[model samples]
Target chain A: MLSNLLVQLINGIALGSTYALIALGYTMVYGIILLINFAHGEIFMAGAFVGLMLVTVFKVHIIFAFLGAMLFCMIMGVIIEKIAYKPLRRSTRLAALISAIGVSIFLSNLANLVFGAKPTTFPPTEEILFKIQTYELIAGAQITNLQILTIVTSAVLMVCLQYFIKKSRIGKAMRATSQDYDTAALMGVNVNRIISYTFAIGSSLAAAGGVLVGIYFGVVKYNMGFMVGLKAFTAAVLGGIGSIPGAMFGGLLLGIGEMLAVALGLSSYRDAIAFGILILVLLIKPTGLFGTQIQKKV
Target chain B: MLVVENVDVNYGAIRALVDVSLEVHEGEIVALIGANGAGKSTTLRSISGLVKPNKGRILFEGSELQKCPPHKVVEMGISQVPEGRRVFPLMTVLENLEMGAFTRKDRANIKDDIDKVFAKFPRLEERKKQPAGTLSGGEQQMLAIGRALMSKPKIMLMDEPSMGLAPMLVQEIFNIVKEINQSGTTILLVEQNARMALAVANRGYVLETGQVVISGAAADLAKNEAVQKAYLGV
Candidate 1:
């Protein structure tokens, strides 16, 4: 039981990384503009499709495929921001939310039409995991290469994002805009430019999450992003919607909690387990762990 | 010096500011006093580049500011403390101050300016690490003013600083506004509190229904029968 728990812990961390990356996209977009960017999941799916096509159809290297996928996803994010978000900005939040839902549905259906409804697999990798140990803390348990790669990739990405948001000039602009868009603009920050940059960064994160999931799970499909995206968003709200670090913390907790629930013999209720946590968190800490409660001036 | 001539602002089809004109000379506190929806806020918004006027030119120090973006206005040394004390609630008081200086490139001057802000608002210094939202209403107002001071603006535009404060806090805020002006920063203040606005201001204008209804020296406007009835409640 102890070894199984430890193994699940490792698995949870690996899964959490992808959630963290995708949640960063969700949180960053929400932070900058207070928009949910519901189509963000479809952006992740599109990125995976881009990677799959690049690797399988063009026979590109995995590295190039990742870059290509990120670039395409970034462009798609910018296009969505310009067309879907910008116009509805001054409108009610409900109007924008509905539009976001419309965009999400449109992209999902669009991807289905373009990529077809078939599940696709990445071409065989020379190495999927590096097995480090066969010695079990309990009988018949081991850590594999795939898990390590997943953990390392996600950790690297999170650290890079931390550096990017904390140290870079554009990162400062994002933080400023997120604090107050009108005030940020008053500081000579271009609101539109910063917003587009935000979308670009977010989409790239989603793209990375897409690729990592593909390698870890050994399957890629147009609909795969839907469930993960929802989970990532759950993690985002769990940590706090407008906070960067909150997303990371929230993702890991949600992933671990989900795994533990499954391990404890509630396997049939995994999805319910995730949503139940969300409801509990919202009821208890509506502003999230790190999120501040904001009050509008009368 | 700044000049606003025949400016008109529209919110959808509703005109918020119609044919509004005003002038601000160097080293003076000019107050705009009016009731709600009298376009006092809109005129300041137009000057600060938050709202682009449909007509007329806003000239700041000889440059036409009719089409300049909001941030560029800050770069040009005009900063506005917006209506209702819209401080970044989640940001630490220090971070809020840093945001004020976001356009400033002179790191040395910025440090000194932060010291200057802390000096002016001692309460903010004690709560510098606290988030702006946690501050009392008076403290938040002080922080808002302190944040704008970090921008090192030649002219500051303030909207309704005393709107929701205790009477004593309002007096304290007005005193700080006077001190800010005396320190050589020109001010364009918008207030519904006419008595206080006129007390600290050298000149004053009264706006009504998106136009300037009255303009005069602060003392005269304060004593004007119409101003007395509408804003001063005299």
Candidate 2:
């Protein structure tokens, strides 16, 4: 029983890292533009499908497949922003949000038309990257190579993102844009470009999450983005919508909570419990666990 | 160095500025003074490319400014210390200063300029790692002015730099403004504090209800009967 719990903990973290990857996109885009890109989940789905095609059809290396998916999703994200959201930027927030939902619907249906509704599976791990092997962690607990890969990928990407936002010029501009759009413009930040960058980074990260999820679960579907998207959005809100570290923390916490729920024999109501936490967070700690704003006393 | 000729600006159905005209010469502190809702900020906004003029033109260094975006305007060496000291509040003081220089192309000189800013306002250096929002109103104002300076702008636009500050802080801000001008930066100052503005400005424009009702040397405007009564609290 103790080993089982440890195994669940590892699985939870692996799953949580994927959610964190996608959650970062939601939080960053929302932080900069105040528009929840509801279409983001579709981007994740597209990334998975793209990765599948790259591996099975193009017969490419797995690393290249992942990179290609991320690149494709980056361009797709920028185009979607330019076409769907940029026009409505000055309009009411609801208008932009509706546009996002419309984009989400349109993309999902397009994927459905192309890929069919049936779930597709990734090539077996040995056929692409490596042979599956498990290493014992504790008395009865064991960790798989794939789980280690997922956690490491997530950790590296998140660390890189944090460092970029703190040290790089464009990343700093992105932070400034999130803080104050007009003030950023006043400081000579091309806010339109920054918005495009936000979408690009968010979408790429989501795409990375998608590819990882596809490999880990060994399956991909046209509508797979729907449930995961909602979960990632929940994670973003749980972490505090505009805070980056909050999204990471929130995703891990949610992942652990969901795994524990499943371990307790509540698999059927997993989504219900996930969303229930979202409701609880909204009702109780609306500012979230890591509110970034430090207000000045005037 | 900057010219606004018969500019008109409207917000929906409301006429914010009607046939407004003003100019600022190189190396001079030009103050645009008026009462609240008198379109002082609108004129500055129009010049800074934040708002487009409905009619007329704005020329800076013989280049038309009606079409440039705010960042493009900054690229041409005009920076505004915007109203209310609108620093990027969550960013560290050093980061805020870096943002001010975002449009400059001389990447290598940015560090030197940052050091220059630190020299001008060493208090900012003391709080370089602190978030701008945590600073006192006076320090924030200094950060704002210091931030604008980081861009190496030829002319600086200052809007209500004394707002929400104590009297002593206001005096200090004005002194800093004067020093900035004396050190070869042209200033177009917008202030409701007519007395302080006139004291620092070489020339002044009195904007009343979207029109420039008076324009002359600062000393003359300060001595004018209507200006003394309406704005200067004589």
Q: Each candidate's DockQ score against the native complex?
A: 0.57, 0.63
Worst 10 residues of 2 chain B by lDDT: B81-90
Question: Which residue pairs collide in model 1, if any?
Answer: A129-A145, A129-A146, A130-A145
Candidate 1, B31-129: lDDT as tens digits: 998889999888988888888999999999999998998888899999888877778877678877888888888877887888888988888899898
**How much is A147 displaced in model 2, in angstroms?**
0.6
Which candidate comes out best when scored by DockQ?
2
Q: Give the TM-score of candidate 1.
A: 0.90
lDDT of each: 0.86, 0.91
Q: lDDT for model 1, on a 0 to 1 scale?
A: 0.86
lDDT of 2 at B204: 98
